[model samples]
Target: MATGVMWSLCLLVCFLIGAARSESRALQKLDTGGGAENARAPPGPARALSAPSIAHDGRLVACSGKYLLGFEPNGSFAWIVPLGHMCNDSISPVFEGEQVYLVAEDKVIKVTPRNVHTAEPALEVFFSHNTTSGRSEEIIGLAISGSYSSLFLTIRNRGLFTFSLHGELQWSVGPALNLFDYHLGCKRNVSGCYFDSAPVLDQCEGALYISNTEGQLYSLYVDNRGIRWIQDLGSHGKVMTIAPGNSACLYIVFPRKSIVVGIDVSTGSISWTQNIGPISIEKNLPTVDSNGWMSIGSLDGTLYSISPDGDMRKFLAKTANDSVIHVGPILDCSGFSMYVAKTIVEGKLIQTVGDYTYVLAKKPSFILFTLLAPATGTVYWTGEYPGELSNLLSSSDLNDFTIDETVVLTLLSAAKTGISNTTQCYTRRQKIACICRQAKAKFVQADPGEPSYVLLLIFLLVVIVIQAVAILFCCIFWRKKRLQDNGLQKFLEKRRSLHSKRRILGKKILELEQRAAEDASSNEALGQLGEMVKVKEGVERKLYESYSLGRDEPSLEQQGSSLPLYHDKYRSHSFHSSQKESITIFNMLSDTSSSEDGTSSCSDDSESCSGTSSGEMELDESKSAEEAGPSNTANVEEGVQHELEKQHQHCSAP
Candidate 1:
């Protein structure tokens, strides 16, 4: 599990390194933003930005002020698109499929990464809000429909809006939430008749859920283009978050009341509602674990776990009033919980007497990170870091270090007790490997930014490429070994055939030993046996020049009127087998499996044995087939007829 999270982090780190590689030499003199963004940020204030989105291919896309930028996965800029109007620095750009949707002042712009060079990157306005002359009409939230062909957004007090993904306005609904606007001190008859929350899609039932300030929930159909249902909970507060619940319901959180309600996705009916406790901040949203228990945070410095049936259990993270539970609980797939809290500490920003211009807050805070046991909320470990983090929600730094723990990475841009304008980066690993960035200079100077992240990407890329190449070569080598074994099988069969013929020749020459003096047929038999002996000798010599293919080829003497060599063959022991070792492909698969030679060599067992490898046997059979054949048979018969006449004439002279 840690390995899986490491790869995901490697992807994020690699893409960030890719962006840093495109930084110009002049960019080093400024802050760490790109392009038209350098003017918005100086050497200080590292927060002028939009939320960056990582594509499936690992490219990072984000917007700064009025421009959209793209970075490749291997460290280079792909394209940049400019929007004429300014964009909200707080709003995050949404990437759906291959396109990007982001807010630009009063318009929602769609960008296509592929056609950035050929055409305008901001292809069209997906939706545009008609603004009232004096009031602000910024988009509150943006989400894409499950079909990936539609978009939904909530304009502050104006209501809910929907559009086709390709720049077509489908429909709009003005919520009836403004009846009690006087309670919140809104003007008598302005454009904001109702305050609406962003639309959240529940993919299970094909519906979108949204809430008004009066606690009224509206269910809208995604495909048929109409309002499905609406229900009011009879409470008044800001709808802080809306989440898709376990199969049957949709969960909504109201931070003012600290109430979490589960609304049925189909009928907009409230099934279960429970108030955990009052939360001091709105960042404490709820998260559901693997077993369907939802966990949330409260001002009491406690983590609360609520089951789907509305049973609530609380575990104390700190003594009440000692620490602030600023963020909610986060659960991995295995039900391990992560909770964040902080305690306000009274300390000055400056630690030394030297002249320092970068003054910090009088009460700088310290953050607390706790890893809790699954479902029990038992503390596994707590990490405390200096400096303040607004909330841990949606932090890209969230990563798994073990099956149940995570590595904590903290970056301090503004130091309260260090040299002026210095930045500190700290990492704590839990069963994971990490590289720390070290800087020795006391004063803030222009150092090469993102050096450690670049080194990490370079190292990971090199290792993965080498492992792939090693596996490929191993496959090729084994394939060649299989083919050599097949040729050896054919060579062994040929050796067996020649040895059986040798046994038959010895038997015939013995039978005709007496008949050579008495009959003509015996003379012919004597001639054929002599020719067979010579053919076997030539083949065995050519094939097994280095090792014996069979016992040394037989020697036949043409002493007059005799098969005398056959008569004395049993006494001489001429067919003894040679012993020689052979080289093998793999030592583990030694040559013990080789077929033994035929029966010509042994006087007792009548079976010869020799040590020859698969490679040597293959070589011997191919050479013998090419050189020895049927032409030698016809010549041997003519020699036998001439010799018979000389014996007959010598008898007549006697």
Candidate 2:
């Protein structure tokens, strides 16, 4: 359990350390955004004024002055048509099946390819119409019915005109009603009308929606060419563009008013008005999706999405270079199985003309070509051009331009050094796909190592810590348990058992051996040395010798002898031979006697020798006793008597 806990702790620490390191690596990657963007740089063309139109066959049709070019998705030209005259600047080409319509200054020509599937097919004029002849009657906008039967045209300073597909004039509405009269507090002079925006035909309701510069939005019932209703937008607040809604309502944007008004198409009455704050410049026409999301871009470089309920969201902030977002936001489908349901648009302007100062370099260029993401409004890839942008064209422009859903395109002005009034094309979806593939590859390569390294480090550290803690706990617990038992005492007993038993026993035996050896030596010494004297039975000898410090004196009391004196054979051992022996006691009682000689001589009969020696010794003793005091003489007399008795007993018995 302890080991497991330690391992867990170690793993945790490793994880933390790895996380910190990975965080650092991630920060390093943060600085690589610029490089990543460079790796997927957008494609560039000379210039373009507006989005390119997609034909029904998935081809992109772009206009460059009198030349109309059809391009494949790779930007390769599929076919080109020279119109012999300049194309209308404000309007785009209308495509229907294999047939395309070009609106020129004074004529409308329908061009068709012999074989659209061929690499470069033969093209010829299918029809032609002299729509107008007046010099000032230039066509500014054009629209075609969804059924490809009716064509709607908006001419400059002229009213709205409708015609059949066969070039027959159907009906015309002109001079929008005057609702702005300055004389009346409630009105202003907006009656000087001119049509600039394109006409919109609603097949569902059999109505056409058109607005003029004179501030009137006319909703005409198309069936009888009768007026449904007219809504005055006030003064120069002409509608810039109109976006039809999901229900009976439609949305219209006014450049001058900087607002979008929602109108009830059934009654031609405004349902709601949303104000867009003051911007750097004009805003593009709004685009509404099937969902109630309306996307619009401003010259201030911001893009906004407003819902039908009037709730607005600023989806994208101003771009990096402060370029005007001339092309309104678009929601492009990724078309990938994984992200099929996910709507992601791609690309936006890289550099922008900023802070206009009325100078050539500082002047606003109005050239923006980008693919936008619908989810976050992020630009994934960009297509570059040098021409002014007119407007954004998408598949939604199919009603008017006959664009196919498969061909996602944008058109821009291509005018450059010597080229004037030319245009270019961009495959927006292709560019977006390129960006996605490149970025994904790079990200996939970068992700694996850093995170794995972090996790491995974390696991190792956790294991190490857990193991250490477990070991430590085990050590402590064991020590405590040992102390709780008789560990100390047992340890001491074990130490004693480890001692040398043989050495201890040997010491004890050596001590006993030493004692025995001493005893044996003493016994031998005693056995070797005989007693000092050995006597044969029958007779025994007693020797006595007396000495005094002073010289001998003759006195009556000294004549008595107290102790017995006898000459001994060992008398030479008592003193040297030259020195005379001095006797303090006198007695003559001994079995053994010696004459006046230095050496001892033993005799079998001792009577004669003893009598002589006894007489001499007695005389010497009496003289020594006379020198002693009366009490000394008495003690001498008793000691002489006892000595004589001992000598008699020794001589008489064994």
Candidate 3:
């Protein structure tokens, strides 16, 4: 069971929205005045920390024991989300879509930055795993696909695991990973394969490249999942870091050997190798600018910029007594700035060219980041922070990365004054910044819904749809009106005739009922009364139907109905006068007369109707239906008289 913990993070609902695009990399100027020290870590009690990692949206995230803290680009506290005790050994979190995925111990947890208005819980345990042998596998690092839709997790002493965004395990390498035996086969002088960092994902080739501690380079295909290739470069100490090159090459840095090896991605072969001086930099990877040059600060006291092709030049070299880079030289997000992970250290005077400050323990060390021109090695901006950055994770793409023009001129002036990296003042702990507000490169948003045009387009489409619906309804009502026009008068006549027939049937039923009472045993009168009642019910039903057919028209007012009226008045009027008689004599005669000259031209009228269009046919059918329902006034009266005469004759004969 995983121990529960509560965490909180501020939700920027508009963070990825198009209207907020300009705001993403925009760093609001932070005020360092009012009780806050000019150079210090975020205000909190000292605790175990992790290296800061940058989110794509420019938010800075790092974990302190059970709490994960996010800072704005301007170094202001953004939010602190709680975590579980199982997530105590936390690595940097990765951002995908809107959720943050973090690996702690053997569990993968997802933290959603919920909007303040949302009541949903933010933190959830996505996955928990242990080796089949019951061995606890601590996850080392997490790598994401170039598309940011999938993830790959590397566990110490265990194999790699790839997962989809929805937490479905896509594939796994091994329950017990022996990279040395499987990939390297213990062929070279290497003894064991240890991975200390996440695999570098080559988005172009759709493959993953990783180097073990023993210099065993391995590549795995993303889409294929299982197939892999490896190359053994003997041993170059523990592989410090691996970065992508201009082409399909992997730059593997071995700090212990002070060597950077470029391996061809396709063949898994070494392309070139450049020797950097005695290397002390560990976690900081070289910054690859747009020009395809890699720049890194080494313990040799030189900032080395190497071309994509095998070439290296010292961007900045220190004299024998000059201080060296202590913490960073880590590049910024736009590939335009460099910042050392801010930390606290105690050292002697190093260099305070502008607002840059770096403190080291006891000895003197000048280590930080600089905005260097790839071609000229011009230092536009540089800064240092107070304290060790062991556990503090932050984004390299932090937005407050610019400095003022005067500060750049001051630092540049030192080159002419021959006093560069000379002016130094020792400080116990300090945070520093200079205004270098250069233009930020524009990034195309994934969800491109610009209010300037997309909103207008959406609105126009909505209006068109509404208008189309209105027109459709109008046409429907107009068609209904036409149908009513063809049948309205015929329906009215049919209704009156039905009423008259109903009256006649009522009188006949009363007479039969009276005769039945007078005889005391006349079943013939009773039977006739029953039949009359049934016919009366059917006539009343037909009358209700005629009114309903014309009910939709305003011409048909809401008259009080004597019975249940139904829709489709035209069809209702066609209902039989009785179950035994499908068509009444009165209705049949009216229909025959209305169609043609009695029955003589009925065939000609039907032939013309068959050739009519659907709209005309509908109207004709409605009219015929109405006429078929008690529309022949002469016929209806004569039929009633004939029925009464037949009844009287039968009674007189008996």
Candidate 4:
């Protein structure tokens, strides 16, 4: 029987345990799934309208709406200025020294940086000139000389114009014969062309290579007015202009025919012509070193870096559709770095530097995000919107120390409150690795091991299992305890029945007591109010009697006085009266007795009468009560006393 009872208890416990488990599971599901949605980090800012361009000193500049501005790498706007309505072009502005040059519909204007480290303290217009004839000639290209002392401008239909840094016109040379006119048999190579590509000046030879829209390339003597040689690339797209380290050759792109051809500067003879597939070349090509190795892009959007021996290396690949239109010139600052501007769909700038790039997507939005790559196509660190960043002109001063300490610090701060708020979690880990990598790139450790990830998963599973087991045991124990107390359970059932009846009766009694207390409070308040009304009546009667007669008048005469006489007497009475005399008069009037009896009954009444008469003279010296009432003398006194009381209460309150 004992064994059977134990088994029965165990079974009952199991059943109860199962029920509790089911309920707990339901509660957990409701808590986790029904309460609220999971919170996610905000998205980064949108892209800028134009790609960021860098200045000589490494300051970044970009056109943001109608304003051109400079910003630090960490995305702080250093300076900004309005370009007015003249800012219509999508092309990034070019900068030199403290001035930036911009091209509009018909004019080219220069503006000072505004935030000059050393100040002559003026945003002087360095130059302004209109190059329009009725319809206005479009300014298609601009290139500053290596010294930045001379400007080379290309205007549609008007040819190339040379000017000094101060806008002085040096020469206006154009109307060159089209190569198509010369080569009648060669089919059209480029779709359309203007002198869009800037002239490449070879100082060693005193010669300039200028290509025109008619698929013609010209080699002109800088000192002499003569064309050295002309090559028909068969189509017009853009001429890839580059000065090779050999100093004797110039590389030009024949985009219409998808060819990259090299020409000898001395004789203008074709040194080498390499076919590089069908691609549209837009801006001037990017060259690494003086080795004649250059990277050029096609309209179809493939980027190729050609070797000195005319061999092509397909290093990076992106389609034209994936690329931005009217992208500024691709720049290769040194052998270690390459820069390109890509326009995002949202009309902001995305600057790719070497293997890393950042997308500056929106306004006041510090989505200055970064993308890093170790190899040709491998992406390294690629999350966290840093913040809004300006242009990056050069990577020369971006040392490991500066990058890790200052640059990283700035990025962390800019990201603290925006889309990057949660980035702090990752930054703490990344900062350690970044510092290690900065010390020695190869010293940087790899990510967490597979074993570590597995261990974390195991830890979570263990916790959940332990909690489930505890809950199951607890429910089992509770059910066993309930079953073991069967005899006591019967007694509890009987006690509960009696307790419930008592609870009902107790509730009814409490309701009746509450009603009785409310009635008693109402009666007490009414009684207090009735006493106040009786006191007011008594006081009024006394006032009437006092005002009816002078102090020296006989009681009989006072009693015989008319209502008008009483009112006049009240108006002429002394303003001040003794408290005792007033109280006695009030009692007498309330009793409706004789004034002699009232005065004789109170010893203080006689003294109060004499005191009141003396105080009357002093009262007359002050303004009348009517004037004092309007002046708020009573209200002022009450207000001061109330303020003091409030301060005392505040100080004393716990």
TM-score leaderboard ranking? 3, 1, 2, 4
Candidate 3, superposed: residue stretches over 4 Å from native = 1-45, 86-90, 115-117, 131-136, 146-148, 174-196, 226-228, 238-240, 318-320, 340-362, 365-369, 383-654
RMSD of 1: 25.3
Off by over 4 Å in 4: 1-48, 88-92, 114-136, 146-148, 177-194, 201-207, 221-228, 235-247, 277-290, 297-303, 316-333, 339-654
**Per-residue alpha-carbon lDDT of candidate 1 for residues 238-268, written as tens digits (9 for 90 to 100):** 4557776454556777766567787766677
Candidates in order have lDDT scores of: 0.50, 0.47, 0.51, 0.44
Indicate whether candidate 1 or candidate 2 has the larger lDDT. 1
Clashing pairs in 1: 18-75, 349-416
* TM-score-better candidate, 2 vs 4: 2
Q: What lDDT score is found at residue 301 in candidate 4?
A: 37
Q: Stretches of candidate 2 above 4 Å error? A: 1-50, 115-135, 176-192, 277-283, 318-324, 331-654
- Candidate closest to the true structure, highest TM-score: 3
The candidate that wins on lDDT is 3
User: Model 4 residue 19 lDDT?
Assistant: 67
Candidate 4 residue-wise lDDT, 1-654, digit = tens: 999999999999987787666545433422232211212211222223344555554455655445555655444445655555455344546656667777654556676775444455424444445555564467666765544367777776667777788767777666354455563211354323356555666544556767676556667665444567776654334445444323355667654455677766667667787765344244434443323356554333345666545666653343333443222123222221233322323344445464333434343222222221112422222222232332221221121111211233223223331222222222222332332233222222334335555666899999999999888865654454323455446535544433433343344334533553365223223222223222323333433332222221223212111000012112222111333223211112225444554322223447765564454434443344344233343443344346555756898999
